[model samples]
Target: MSRVIIRLLLTLLFLCPILAHSQLEDIDLKELVAGAQEWAEENLDTNVLDALPELDRQKAQKFLRDLQKQFQGEYVINLAALRETANTILPLLESHEETRPYAVWLRPRLDYLKIADEFLITIPPPKVEPGEPAKPIPNPGPIQQRAVWIKEVERRPWPPAASNHVARLKTVFIAEKVPPELVWLAEVESSFDARARSPVGAAGLFQLMPDTAKRFGLSLWPRDQRLQPEPSARASAQYLKLLYERFKDWRLALAAYNSGEGTVQKLLERRNARSFDDIAVYLPAETQMFVPKIEAVLLRREGIKLAGLVTPRD
Candidate 1:
């Protein structure tokens, strides 16, 4: 299958559960699959399609399928298996100009994979009692995970693209009345790479999804403004500002940014929670990791805690 088809299948397998109660809840599974297959056939990147035929089809399909499964699995511990595959794929993706944008998207996430593996190695598995089912061990809470991520991130050098983009992006955030330091979000999202794109269609420096991008006044056709740093940054900042306003807390705002506002809001209401920590465990594993990862990135880049961030100025 083509990469597009593979991604579509993986999305259906993994993301459907996460989206079940969100806006896409009512979507018909069969129709969604048929539409995705048609889109894949119609919109396959010629270069990628051409390249696919030259590979050993079975091996390639297996590799791609396994990669997608591990990457999209609900548990962070599953990411451990992806580290080697990521290293191998990163260089290959970077070697082709047509595929380099994917490399940009994958590059920063390699850190997450590495740290997740380390976390698994460091934390002992929960002990099981005789004649009882062995339950999975829960990950450390966000506060503990944030400290771990801060240490990991602190040792890394700043992404080169950030030097060129941060000043410009910060100005856009400030113009949108967002806290300028929050512009470092690009570092966490895309490593400040304007061409970065997730397989699920989030794009650009801030990785704005199509729906969110359009909601914030970005044009998707004729030209995808999400790939333009200033426009994407403006949309991102506005979205963040709106999220912060809704949650009245930066940690909650960041969580909503990653996992959808509806998802975070519902969790908060269900749990009677006012803070990210209260609902963190109930969140999808990616969101659980994501909020703390951003906190670590912010702390490492700007030396500010999420709680220390000020509201957008008028």
Candidate 2:
């Protein structure tokens, strides 16, 4: 009897903790990642946790810490909030519960992550600080101005001679991985006038609308540099490059450039187009014509000499 009672006591003691833990509901990596994805998509600006790499989870945690430090007065963390934060951040990289269809607790959180991801994609990369030792600048000889200007002239855009400035602008863009076709957009939108203004409050040679400019963290101060022919061209090119990384298709990227990425993404969700021409018509009218015009000019310029024309080299 004594031996049996001892054995029973030992079993109960071991089972007690296990039963308690089970009652409390244990969360693990799988649960955390799912909860995070759902929560982030629903609440924050975008699901920053998703587009960024999985190895960066520690960094994301650090970011949260930094945020906590920066705004100590504004935010506080509790158990529930920590669970929510984990849910919002983790699934962005890891999806563990492949078989489980749904976690009722995690669904609401993923909604916010979706929105956060949307906004995050639009945010430009941080700029390198000035006063870092300057790198040697390479000199690109000659401007592709006439090609840029004549296209503007054809559209009856002001500043008829503006296309002549393309060669000068080309130098800045050549080093960057920007598509050459985008240079013509500057001409069509702003007439190569650094101080160009549009009826809808688009400014700069690139005609970046104020909201679009702001989204890139561009400041509208005494004068928006985005309107400046050279700077605006660079900004536009960089923006396009970023879009290309997101969509992988130049046409879809261009559509995202003209319209918002959200718009392009929605269309992609709808038409699921395989090529630019397939989805080009779905873009805004001006954007619809935008790609073709740029293509036409670029093709003509590249093959002008082949076409038996005296295309001058700058």
Candidate 3:
């Protein structure tokens, strides 16, 4: 047999007798590790020391330190550190069958260390480098940036391509006893596309379906007046006003607009909810994201309005 295997056999032979005579929990764990290491190191130069590189020896040494930390007072396992150190050691040892057995023997001891930790709060591993890699900074995602950017855009004090239509709808919204700013709904609904027609038959700047347009006094007989910006904005605004009256919350009203009033109302009643967020979980995928989309656009419009008030810096 290879010298490493003979060494491992001798080490285990020594440890196995001690292990059998004493329960692992009852014995001093440090002694258990020290005894194993002392046996592994004894007569080192005379045995397989030439076959085992210094790097492998260093890994074993670190493992000894790790074992001390893991089984010492207030015993705890640093799982992440244990895993990382194991990664470093396993590859070096597993190339040879004799050394592989050491890893096999060590696995149970590693598991035993975890069993000893009293809580999630582990003893931090000794610092190996300057700063930890995973900490120090966090990066935002596109969706998060989209939400923030959209709100900041709303505060700009200038009108956009869609603003003229919003101005036209002011009288319409006022006539419907709704907030004029809500005309931004049309921009989100149809992108102010007066000729906008959905595959589902929703049309105009407001995206009102034929039946909805008919109820609001629009005609499709002569021509689909649902395609007219003026009348459609009036209809869209009136619908918003109607929804606000029913739900008594503008955000929920907007969610109703996106998800269908009946659907939203049922979710609210089923959930015993009064806020959009509470019922939002049950909303359709489009509606789930649509409300925030509208708010982003609305906030951008608000930004434009506010930006207009700021005097030129230069």
Candidate 4:
């Protein structure tokens, strides 16, 4: 072989691993989209389409377009290529933390992609004729279906006793600089019963478990401080703030509050899913309904008489 051929071969050998590593990272991101789709399909209640802002849609669209350019050499999507891409990303996502939610959320949309024979198709512009006005292109079928899931949450049956504690919880949450609207959550947990105790040992209006109570500075040694309304309310607010920081979404934060942050975190790992709604079906039945119950109470308190039970959102 000539010296030039040998040099080129050596250079390619050196660059191969670096290129492979880059592709691995790219695959993880693709898995995130897939996982999100999966979760959305798994939980039929919430609309992943409506929750996203314009910027997020644009970002996802851009990411999808980038992947298309990378893999769609001939400009046609095929099942084998899509399957190979999914297999590469799903395993890597199993152990991931931060991006795991996105993966869980995106994976299920593959059915729609396969059925529709595309990922996301552009809504075509209006068609015009020589004399007639332009006829607007209709919203595509998948997007229209996705939009159907977006509905307003309805009010729940509020225990009269629950409203009695709202004034106190408002004080506690406002003192902590958290949203006072969260006061409604206690209504779902324990019907605002200060001395309430769950079958699993969660106590007080918030029904915090033992470890969670201790983590928020509750003294359970000489006496169970979780039974006290004032201390328990404060601790609950503080804990919710921490959960909000961790999940960055109120619904997920509340899920952590109900099921233990560790439980939710582990659940996120297991499903590689997104928000509470995305992975709701995989959670304990009580934990699954926790956020919706909270939303229902909030809507009732605000005097919005919605008829049906809509999915809870962030």
Cα lDDT computed for each candidate against the true fold: 0.69, 0.43, 0.52, 0.50
Residue 196, candidate 1: C-alpha displacement in angstroms: 0.6
Residue pairs in collision within model 1? none
Q: How many clashes would you count in candidate 4?
A: 21
TM-score of each: 0.81, 0.44, 0.48, 0.46
lDDT of 4 by residue, 169-215 (tens): 78888888677777766765666766454312355777666666776
Identify the runs in model 4 with alpha carbons over 4 angstroms from their true place.
1-158, 303-314
What is the Å distance of residue 54 in model 3 from its true position? 71
Name the candidate that leads on TM-score.
1
Each candidate: how many clashes? 0, 40, 17, 21
For residue 123, model 1's alpha carbon misses the true position, in angstroms, by: 1.3
Clashes of 3: 17
Best by lDDT: 1
Which portions of model 1 show Cα errors greater than 4 Å? Answer: 1-73, 312-314
Quality of model 4 by C-alpha lDDT: 0.50
The total of clashing pairs for model 2 equals: 40
**Tens digits of per-residue lDDT for model 2, 1-314:** 24355334433322221211001123232333335434333322212233344565454544343322211111111112334454654454344221011122222223223322332343333445786664322111112222332343343432454666687677656655664545666644544555443212345666665555655666666455674666677777677677777887665666566556665665566677665555554443334434444444445444321122221233
> How well is each residue in 93-163 modelled by candidate 1, as lDDT tens digits?
67755456667887877877887788788877888899989776566677778888888888677888889
